[model samples]
Target: MTTSPLSWLPLPSSTDRAEDEPASESDDQALDPVQLAALHRGRDAGEAAAAWVRSLSGRQENEDHALALEHAAAGIERASHQEVIPGGEGQLAEELRYALGADVLLGATHTGTVPDLAAGERMPLVAVCALAAAMPSCVLGDLPRELTLLAAELDAATAAGRAATTATGLAG
Candidate 1:
């Protein structure tokens, strides 16, 4: 018999047959280690974001902030289930840079105009933004804008607080 061009490759044995079969939908739903890690990170980030917002004056009793945090958490959970496309390295890099910048700006609110917080302190923000970035633009409608506004408000409030504290110190 003439040798086939594919003959050089070893064929799957009986035991390996199962590995070649397509996974069912239920099987696909099961998260691998990386997905599980992302989910946990998202949960932690949601908690951090909620706590940070609550720590702001008058925000602890704001129902709107609570609702926004809930929405963000839900979005992160949905985004976590999305599959990463192969050969999108450039897109991924851009997403990561954007996420980092967004998170750093948010983190600056906690550090009083300087994004010099420890990595651990900023990680949750980065994780949240990174997951948010992975979501499709159609699904992510309004979120980035909302987050930008929130960040601006928080940063302005922080700067004001710093100025007040400095004036009080100088006067005393």
Candidate 2:
């Protein structure tokens, strides 16, 4: 039998699987951070692999990312993950904006521009979406998943801006 790339190497044909003890639920909950960190590192590597595939992309294979945003926001509501609106989509909107602002702040902090808040506002969504849309077809297709995620994140950010405008009666 031919082995697939991801399949285990025949286990040396002699190892008994029944001898291994199953982990208890308590043991599962006690995951060490170091091991979790390795899993996160693997995910980071997978993103790089995705980027490589994206470079060879052609026609659009974009995921319905707007749905992902709505789902994520709904999940937050279900989990009582409120921020400002007590119990609603507005709270999710606020949370999303804060998350986006955090990324900008992180960039400013890294670039030693903490004293200049203007440095943080430079990376706006319009700029990014325009940049992505200008990319080659293969590059866009290869990154369908990442683009979906980015879109969801931006949707959240935009929703937050909407919420702020609503509060000020300017959105009406």
Q: What Cα-based lDDT does every candidate model obtain? A: 0.35, 0.28
Q: How close is candidate 1 to the true structure, as a TM-score?
A: 0.26
Question: Once superposed on the true structure, which residue ranges of model 1 sit more than 4 Å away at CA?
Answer: 1-59, 82-123, 135-172
Kindly list the per-residue Cα lDDT of model 1 for residues 1-172, writing each as its tens digit: 1211111222443132254655433342433454333333333333344344223312223344334334433433333223121111213234334333453334324434433332333444444445444432311334234333433433343344334434444211
On TM-score, the candidate that comes out on top is 1
Structural similarity to truth (TM-score) of each candidate: 0.26, 0.23
Error of 2 at 146 (Å): 1.3
Candidate 2 C-alpha lDDT tens digits along 1-172: 1111111112345232334544333232332444233223222332332232222121112222222223333322221111211111222234444322333223233444321222222243222222222211211232334333433444443344334434544322
Off by over 4 Å in 2: 1-141
